[model samples]
Target: MINAESSAERTVAGPLRAAWGSRAEASALADVLLPPSTALPGFADPERWPPNALTRLASVLDLARSERGTPWPQPTASQYARFFRDGDGDRTDYETPVFDLDHRLTRAVLAALVSRDDDLLDEVADGVLLLCERSTWCWPAHEEHHRLRGAVVPDPDLPYLDLGAGVVAAQLAWLDHVLGDRLDVRWPGLRARVRREVRVRVLDPFTSRHDWHWLGLDGDVHNWCPWICGNVLVAALRLVDDPADRARIVADTVRAIDRYLAALPPDGSVDEGFEYWWNGACRALEALDLLEHATGGRLTAADVPVVRETVRFPRLMHLGGPWYVNLADARALPSGGQPWHVPQEWARRVGDRDVALHAAAQRSTAIPDTAELGRALRDLATPLPDHPAEPLVGSVWLPGTQVGLARATAGSTAGPTLVIKGGHNDENHNHNDVGSVIVAIDGVPVLVDAGRPTYTKQTFSADRYDIWTMQSSWHNVPEVRGTPQGTGRDHRARDVTVEDTADRFQVRLDLAPAYRVPALRSWWRTATLHRDRQRVTIEDSWDFADHGDSRSTLHYLLAGDVVRDGPGRLVVHPVSGARATLVAWNPSLASAALTVRELDDPLLRTVWGEKLTRLELRLPDPARGSLMIMVEVCA
Candidate 1:
């Protein structure tokens, strides 16, 4: 194991220090971020706070109070380990209880504080103590650590600082910070246990260890780094009393955040898709918000350009209507009622009204829970400006992941839009798609990506690629010599370039390297969007230096409804008058035969709410040849 003390020491003078600049800036940021140990702010009484300000807050508390009658679910070691031994079947049952408990305790405490319901104070006190005393507040995977080959996770008595566990502790700290005076009134030791558990699981372990994958100390960074660090900031700011100790934790958090930032491409494209972007980047923003609040204004996302760019990913990733271009293990289609506060709030921080407006246009008036009192409070403080949806301008090319976005007009959801992707198969949540594309007309999707299935043991195991939804065969790409694209960072597209204009959009990708076959020479696909023409033409050309009879099969995935129109044309019928006509080129190939296959995966069911259909184009395989597919949308 690495000497965590040394690692923590380096954090003070390392990349984070460089991001902060100078010893003075670092010291000042640490001061504002940790704030001298003091009493946490109390929850303002709803009666006198603001009119209807606590309405959503009250609703959250009411739901929790209602659920109080439901028995708290218990999780056992066997139930937790079932996934490791048997797969993903029973793990959710074990997990349901944890979420229920977390929600239960959170609601009880918020009700006691927000409504000042003295009747629920004892329940709040008991809830906090029970959570703090749970054998494991973390998920089965984190506590068991079965990911590594033949590795046995140490059975520690202390509550783990995993994402789930860390968030729970952070909430407990908030409870203690605001109502410690009240909680202390009941058990006295309850507040002390909150602090001790946080130290034992989060602070001490985080500052001293580099073993956590999310810490990014080993050079690999992803969503977890920012997610868990956010909770650390929550716990440390409200619970850790010692200034030096708090600074140490904050330094590690800053250092960890640097890892998440470092993982992002310079162009700010999230290859893991927008759903994970929300899960990760949004959480990071929350941490930054806390840091900004604690430190007055000396340090925050406003000081960093990359932070602004990173937070802008969600809006730019939109793939026309009803989708945000989610790829990989992310949901194939973005759900309705997406959260807008992160982008809206981040845009306001950076003073970018355009982005702020984009988020505002799509913002919903719904609120999920008051458990995240910090974010709720921030939401209340930063009132979003009402902004209407605008047409999307030109096109966006994220060179890092080779993901391209082109729309007919700026913010035109129901217009001609094309999202093309050509990156390696190994990403945060990878899928083996080298040359894949999606086509949407007037916000109606004609060609789509089979994003993912309900996660199970196979989803994250060595057999991950075995799942059809994760393979290139299931994507908008072709299979060469009956072999699909390989999975790994090394298995990526090469020689990718894009050209965009007011009326014409073209993306060219050299996908020869992604396949692992000696006989494979070169495979290239180009997607051209004629904006005014409302037409998209996808051309695939391939050749082998020394081969024949290659046998390549082209495929396309579609949602909603589709039907055969003619010899070389098929029409897709959506809910309204929005219809897309697909025309296959190369006369002979376009007229060849078309077959339909249904995907019965839950992921597809979740997105389409029904089984999605796949269209197959059986092109005559000459070993070395070309194929073309066209999709034209009519106004």
Candidate 2:
């Protein structure tokens, strides 16, 4: 519901205005900015590190040793032109090399630091030189020149400061800060090349340009604001020796970050879902940490109210290990691509032990492969706490985002859990699923959301909803009069309410507003989780203006192998090690049919395998009727 006008009004003097308001504060911050020598951690000199920091980096050193002779994947011009030439948006062809180059540099730099080996210095110099030789660091999808002009390839003179560019800048900056002196000993002018490339590609454009949409000046901010700012801030602090330039970059980045913080829901719910929280909210928190460090505690994340509230978002949306309330474009199983250490540190700063534990658990469980060298270095250097990791155990209701999660027991994923959302269709990475619900049993999704498919040209274009995964019929919601939920902010749930008690938790909302059916009056939907019975129930009571050949259908996308037991009853077998569940509906009101939807996208196949089953309850007559569905774990 936030537009440019409203966001602009709030950005004038938002929550972070007190942190760095006037020119005096800006000058004070500049006066105390960390010098280039100590801007980042002393990975170059590990003797001053914490006791176990070097030990933790042993794996990275080994990885560096293992890939010592492997050939780096080199990107070609054809790969870069694939998008502009044929409308292909798959970024793996060109991005794989970018990632490989960064990873190689990161591993070599850390390995040399850990083992004090001069042999690895040659590989490090190669990475730095290779980065400097690249035509563009920006990903092809983010390359605006293709859309702005008819150019097929990036212009060497104009660098697009997108996420990929920011990531490379930070990577080069960190490595230079850590190994610049060492490189000078052998590679000579390579350090200067890195400095020049970073200045041109990331720092110069970031500071000089005012029209970049991600800056949030025009109130169109999302995860990109904090993510790019955080990375750009790293490059600025580490590479920019000029105090005034550093200060201006820091101040401008802070204002943009403040705009992002102001735009967040007060309850700290991320409509982009759990995956983006690390990139969006956690990145801002990391930026705050950098500011606090540079200013000697003048600015702290603890001073921000939204930071404290937003740190627990991942925990709130968690549905056991690797399973979250996968709404919007977020997948059910997270890629863990972002840095977990950032959120872990944020949780510790905000004094939330549960969230801290959850983040640390994520760090421990997921495979660590990141192109952000700053976060990667920090992840290796930071030590995890000495406690077991657990999911957010109990029920939570975030009224700001209108999301409610209910579980049968506290601190244990023993039974059923119900997650319901009553948000608009125009949310970030929005899917036309205004009144969708997810049912999880012991942390495994039974009645599921299909998440998202691999990104293509159609993913973010005008034809976005044409993708079946982005449609309402694929979600656990009702389609009235053969019309699916509409898209946009106006098409959203109405009169949403949540009630959490000892024996039961319930969410009530009217979803009629989400549809565009002229014959529809109101579709009142109630989803309840009975903790005592350990069952989840979804009831849709809809009213129609006329009975004239109108019919509505309730679509429930179920994961795993689905078997129809008999009329009005179906059983879902376990998928991906989760337990099975029984889905039962009233036969008197509607007939049931199961349709198998085969997964073709490689991305979706990773989570749901080759296929997913959709169970539809068809209301033969849709004048005024109700449909009730109950899902319970089978004994």
Candidate 3:
């Protein structure tokens, strides 16, 4: 994709500026750029701002000027070595501090722009150099993978670049744009080094590849495509002073963004769940916002219909509580609900006032990590509009993906809400469970998805299913014999049907193929939510032929505490105090017992903050038969 360009390229792209030159482009982007005398959000005094987002971030650099004058301890490679050896790349102590390097850099940039504090900028100079001088801004685990798993086994000895390369390059670019002059006069060598490093490391390598797994080279490139590319573009437009180089970067962006848009599901769904929906879409939006701002909307991708439709994904996927139909590594609830920046940005673009209010109300929740300074800059410049709440009612079924979301009502607090998933196990960050179901009474989630557990070496390896959370045995699905659902594209639901009406919603899925068990002849499940009765029914029909002797156990994963009155009946109490009675019965099965399983892990502790529980209903295997489970919300 990066070769010699012709005269046509020069004439057409015309300096990568869809409009060109900083003055006019900045003029066109008057609404978005930081206004004169504009103070950054939470920058006034910075003493009483929200402690977590900025104030606490400022604490890392001893910016709070609170008590101790100590700065954040710098990170080392040894800090990440053990985590890589343990196969947990993301959890190392190096993660947060390394991330804070950017956090501090962003703060410094904000200080330069809003407060014009030379004293604050002086304090942050060492931090930027600390990051820029590192061999790679990426984690050691990524470096480990690069060392071990290159296509030729360590043959490509080039610098290992992952998501961090783009992150650092982009941040540095913005840092330069906002205060390059100050840096030039005070620290010329450091300012020049930043540009030189971005070009030598990120730009040169990025434009060279068209299909690097992170680039939308093959199948659906996950968040990394836009997350990395978008930031790189921001870096290029901000730092690369040469018009030809900038034009080349823009050409690469056109190719990259086109692929990114192409890979998005037409229904605007992310199989990785809404947590990823926020990460992936929000990062992509960052790129889109930059493009519109830089090119004056001349080189915009928003006209792509799927691009516009993706705005609804966060709202559409938000089940009343922290609950989401989340598949993959995503929890049923998120660390923080979808960031307000997402909905706020999309609301104005999509002209949905309901979403605008949703974002405005949600903005104060948590600030984003990547483009925090950029988001803060925009918030101070063009804040979210005040809009009235609009009802969010509807059943959305994406036929292509076999995911169904049925809201109780747009705003109802007392009704049965059902979310069912029947997709293949090959999805990104997938769990082996295909025919999984989650039911909630009002906003209280009764049955749940055992989300993801603490990731280890086995988390991404061939032994992923060995972990309980990644298997069907721990999900709201049936385990045939001892065989839970298998992973990969082949083991998936078949002949799925979704029927939604004003009164009731039904989704039927065949789970026979999902199980690799030889004894499993056939399995079908029909999950119906009777809104009128506020009841949810999960009907399963199993045919085992002679293999009926194989023990069959089904599970109902619940978020809250569980109480069992009998083998056939159990009561689920979501933390919100809402309760639902689950009754399982079959004509052939004479005796059944409900057993519980629990897990304690660090990640689980943070996500759920309690012991995770799953009720396993053990039953006698009939020659062939059906089982019906009814969940009735107590009046």
23-126: candidate 3 lDDT, tens digit per residue? 22333343333322221122334434433444323433344232122475567656656555444544547676778666766756665554555666664566
TM-score of each: 0.90, 0.95, 0.85
Worst 10 residues of 2 by lDDT: 1-10
Q: For each candidate, what is the lDDT?
A: 0.69, 0.82, 0.65
lDDT of 2 by residue, 102-208 (tens): 88788887777666577788878777778789999998888878777879887879799999898888888888888788888888888778889999999888877
Clashes of each: 12, 0, 1
Question: What TM-score does prediction 3 earn?
Answer: 0.85
Better of 1 and 2 by lDDT: 2
Error of 1 at 245 (Å): 0.7
Candidate 1 lDDT: 0.69
Each candidate's root-mean-square deviation in Å?
3.3, 2.5, 5.9
Instruction: Give the residue spans of candidate 3 off by over 4 A.
Output: 1-69, 87-90, 144-157, 365-371, 385-390, 518-521, 577-596
Best by TM-score: 2
Q: Is candidate 2 or candidate 3 better by TM-score?
A: 2
How many clashes (backbone atoms < 3 Å, residues ≥3 apart in a chain or on different chains) does model 3 have? 1
The residue ranges of model 2 lying beyond 4 angstroms of the native Cα positions read: 1-11, 23-25, 50-55, 365-371, 389-391
